[model samples]
Target: MNNYYILGLDIGSVNISAAIAKFSPDSDNLSISGIGRARTNGLKKGVVTNIEKASTSIRQAAKEAMKTAGCKPDRVVVSIAGAYTGSVKSQGIVSVPSGEISINEIKRAMQMAQDNAIIDKDQVILHVLPYEFKVDGQDHIEDPIGMSGSRLEVFTHVITAEGNSIRNLIKATNMAGLKIDNMVLAGYASALATLTKDEKELGVGLIDLGGATCDIVVHLGNSIVYNDTLPVGSTNITMDLSRALNTPLANAEEIKINYTKLLESGVSELQLPTMGEVSLTHEASMDIVTKVIYARIEETILLLLNKFENSGYLNKLGSGLVLTGGMSKLDDIRNLTSLMFDNIPVRIAKPRSVDGLFEVSEDAKNSCVVGLCLYGSGEFTRYEIDSNGELKYKDSHLKSMTSTKSVNSAPVIEKEKVEYKEDKSEDLIKISKISEKNAEDMHTFTKILNRLKQLF
Candidate 1:
């Protein structure tokens, strides 16, 4: 059991789940030794509204995981998702030095594009993904490393969010007594664990339906081409059910899981009371509740469709939508989603391996946690610290802003990854998804602070 130890923690609205990896470095396959989970009470819609409350939930979950793993988790990777998360596209280009394009030139172009695209002062750029590069007149090139060209142009997908929201998340996590080793974008984490290389290369739309947020990621031609977060999630379905059935929220959720309806049943002959959990005096057909629930789910789908269509990724989809997350466990979910998008195949997906627990309907739910372990195990980006203890990018490849003085020069290369479970001493702590309990809602922040703010 001492093979290789890595901890992955996924903080969600409904539950906090963790996994300890028993690394079999001698083989390709991995085993998850101890999986721990606890109910989450301090979060709302995937964001921490109350730091103290959120911290309590995280600490409880971590403590359980630590006991199971038989050791304290000195280093951890946390997932981040909030209402402020969003995406946009940008392009960068540079004349080929000596009328010829090299791998370095292409890399420089990507950095330029990311630097040029960031317009908000308060927003923090999370991921700078170089989707594709065009060398001279040739296009659709995934890598032009050995190719020759007169100019190199790059198109990238930029994902960003409110900086304060991210800071709040970090603060709460620190308060919970866990040192975060890495910060991974939640949707990307989900994709890496669930999406096949072919699916990502051929272009697929991954829709992860969560409790409070529906995340949309468009992976096409090898990288994520677009991403966005919709405020609506599975919780909306519960709310709609409660309102339509005139029952309490808890009972509505119970009915959603326990009830069933024939796909073509234009009418539900079953009777349900509108007032309470255990009332039978008045009987109303159950069809109304089902249809109402279906309608709300459809609207959320439509919202995603609109985002995809408007982003021009609708036509580029070669691989159809892949849906996952705890919310994707609903019965006949594919059938309901199929009707919303024309000719698009919809299916539930889950983590391929390293499993012990999986609810039949929680394809999307496991993706993030599983992906976090996979991400921490594999090296993606690197970060460093200054005398002041602030976080700084270890490599130029990850810099959001290209320094004017260093733009034309080749940046220094560092030694590849070496393990260190050091605490983040004075690094930036991320707080995300400002809910009502966080003292100010995102809407309120946006309205009051009309001035633009810049962040890394």
Candidate 2:
């Protein structure tokens, strides 16, 4: 039996988490094998600032996970976040040949979208998610193939990131002796772990409040329509507490994590420990702490709301907001978010349906890493470490099918020439019809022939 081991590595400003899982070819199920976590020092706002420190953290975390799982993994699917990531919605249109749309035509339309996207030279495309397809003048066509149409148009959300930031992250991971199989946006990964199919289909917003960055992704019409990251996150709250209370940074973090509460009923006074003291050695008015924390959190929420408004989808989120990340564990966060967003239904999201032994701390903070594992189990891409210790994409294959799968188990296979069978039970219709020539290779010729016949 062929078994594939996969790893998900999430490198954050405050912590690095690793999740290991195994995909058995016969069962197509990804079973949890092990997990590891370590404090990170080299990243600031999810970007690698010190390669050495980041590499050390990655190495330590992977080693610990390998030890726990009793199996070493060479490749990992990494999660990328920070302010450098950006996304834009673009559309592409192409004339269909023979009045029938095929998978090749869809690819061409997608390629046109990519070609038409105005991206900076210093940025790299991360993901291209199709929002909707249109045949002729009709809209909302999810599967345009096998449909009769003269023109096919596709709307896509293209994600891009700063080239330098991505390079730094890759270099650090390579230095740590781990090859990256693929990279996923942190917001999208978290949404995969926490969001339900109904929320995604009915339109929803996901806010991931990490230590140093807040990531947002909006889903509408069963696709991601908007994604962006803000520099402000829960760390700002700690900093405000530290500056206002004249406390050390470490002590401020402790208070923010342990003592700070979002009190909806508005408590008048509360007891907290003094600076440098472990016990409750001092009494501080709850109003003061409330002001400090609320100021920053409110600012963050307003910024996110402003972005959502600018995107023109603030009113369309029928499912409201889902919050996750390190700060989502804070007391009364759901209440605060609901109040700030005009009582829009708000809920704290955590990794669900996990099959492994996870610590209490892994509840909310480990969503990205666990989502990465889930993403890998559904995809069939291979990465290998080269002689120079750099991660290189080797090939793509069809991942084995499994019976027990979650809503997030959709395969993420890249565009490659691989044999696949038609499964009528699945949502995505597989292209099982093939000729002697590969679909990609014959696309242009087929289109030209059809055009010539029309001219004749």
Candidate 3:
């Protein structure tokens, strides 16, 4: 039995969360062993402002999680915010040399697509997800491995991030005594944890509203097609409240949480302390508080709505929109969102299920962290490009499948027997067996060539 531990860390502007999942290779279930969170101090709008403070927060979260799990995880799967992320769609084509497509042909096409993408010099590719495939004159071919085709073309959505920002995150994690197995987009991670397979296939939009940033992701046909971020979030509302009501930021946040409701409410008045002079107290109207919160939230939703409309995926979201994160817990957020989104179906969501820790699954704020665990436990794409930009096969964790076999169980195909002529007049014959999985470990040449200067 190959039972392993996967540690997922989501370091955001408001909080740094860590969760440990115990997974068995033979089963589809992921058991949550522990979870921990700490207030973040070194981040502003999800970008690390100070590596030392970020590392301290990461250490605190990881240490607490490990202590609860009674074991230290060697490598962690971390989530990167969408603030520094960008995505582009590209296509690659190659002739089928053997008149049939194989893994090599597929890899070549994906590498060509990566090469075709135009990006800034300071950015690194984070994910290369294939959304469509064309074989010869045919279009939308899912897998053309065994199909006869003269040319194989693949359309992929590539996600990239600023190199400096990624390096800073990596450095902070390393300082926290954790090696990163992968870095996933926080938006994509949240979608993975909250979205059902049917929703992905039918097209769905997910928004993760965090403390200082709102991350957007559109999923269609089992892959993310678009990813974006907004600099405004729940913190903006708090600031607006502080300014509008002439109150301290702490008190403003409390009011936003407890008093303000987007919908109508009867609680009309509250005793509020002055901003600079807390000793002096005054009565504040709940109507003003509600309006302040509503304005900021409405602005945020409109910005997100505009972004989605411009992405060309607005009409494609047949399954509608799903909202998660800390701000989604705000009173009447779903009702307000539905009204803003033209009454299209809107649902406030969190992690769909968590085996051990109920708290993690209960709160929408923990979506990204739980999704990181799912991603780490092989609950993502079948083929993925690792952080090192190598093509790797990931076993699907779907429960509907009859088998949960991994690459280690891949079939070994015997090579054709060969005979060698020797000068000694004796013929040597040999047969060799090679595993199909071994041939899939090919490096992405485009990334390697682009980063060759860094290797020196």
Candidate 4:
């Protein structure tokens, strides 16, 4: 059984994570073979501050994962943070020379859309996601291939990132001895791992609150309509606590993760160490810590709310908000987010289930990495822009389905043929019995006629 292997790398400001997935085409099953994470100090928000340090971090994480999997992957799908990324909407139209839409025409339409989009000179297109298609004058067509049409058009969401930032990331990955197969938006990757089909169709909002950045994506209908990133994240809260309590940043991070309650109303006491001297400690009120954490979280949520409102998709979120990433583990985050968003439903989500994903699936922080693996396995949209920046139809799974049937159909057809022959044999037996009965009647008629002749 041939299997496909791919590694997913999520390079974050605070940490870098890598996961290996093995996908079996015969069974259509995806399984996680290994997972790795390492502390990183090379990135601030989404920008690579030090390529050497970032490359070291990536190498460590990938090495650990490869050790566990007992094999090294030739290529990887990596996540690009949303901080340095932006998207624009554009449309493309073309006259179909074949008078019908095919892969070539679809690719041309997507290329036209990319060419037509107005992008900054310092940025490059990462994805051209065509959400809606039109054939001739008809609109809202999802797939135009195999359909008769004189004209083909596509409406796309073009995701672009700063050229320098992208180059830096690619360089770091190359320095780590890894080749990148695809680069995905961090927010979209998290959404793919955590969101259900119903949530996506019903319109949902996803927020990936990591250490130094909060990435947001609004998925509506069949594709993401809007995405943005905020520089503030859970790290802001830790900084606030450190300043307010005169504690070390590491201690403040520990306190923020373990002590603060955002929605609690009770007061408590705590002991915190001073910034430079671990031996020097002082009493601090839990109320102060809670107040500081709440202030930062509220600010982050408010900023996100403003972005959502401006996106023109605020009212379209039927599935409300799904919160993920490391920050989502905070106590009562959902309650606070719900209240701030006017009581629209809210839930904290982790990565969806995959086979052999034991510990990693339990944390929301792994959503992006896991989703990257899924994307590598062709679990993303039906149509996607390839690494060459050209839109391609992903029909491998469909081809697998057809291949499976072709392999299995012969036996099934043969069984049906055998059953059909048995039925035919039963009909022949019934006909033979009827023939015998007819012969008996004929013989009885002849005897009656003979008896009548003798009487005469």
RMSD of each: 9.9, 10.0, 11.3, 23.3
Candidate 2 ranges beyond 4 A from true positions: 98-100, 260-287, 358-362, 379-456
Query: For candidate 2, which ten residues in a row score worst on lDDT?
Result: 380-389
**After superposing candidate 4, which stretches have Cα over 4 Å from the reference?**
260-267, 397-456
Can you write out model 2's per-residue Cα lDDT over 291-357, one digit (the tens) per residue? 7877777788888878888878889889999999988877677887888789999988887666556
Ranking by lDDT: 4, 3, 2, 1
Give the clashing residue pairs of candidate 3, or none.
none
Task: List the candidate numbers ranked by TM-score, top first.
Answer: 3, 4, 2, 1
Q: Model-by-model lDDT, in order?
A: 0.64, 0.71, 0.77, 0.78
lDDT of 4 by residue, 1-456 (tens): 567677899989888999998877778788899899999868888689998889899999999999998887644789989989998898878778767678888777776666567666666677778788888789878678899978887888887778668767876876787766678888888988999999988989999999999999988776787889988888888889999999999988988777535235354777779988869999898878878877888888999999888999989999899999999988778999999999999989999889986788998999999999887776777676643353446676445433332221101100011222222122110000001112245577765653343222
What would the TM-scores of all predictions be? 0.74, 0.78, 0.84, 0.84
Q: Could you give candidate 3's per-residue lDDT for residues 97-199 as a string of tens digits?
A: 6888888787787777766666666567788888888888798676676788788888888888776687677667766766666788899889989998888
lDDT, residue 25, model 2 = 58
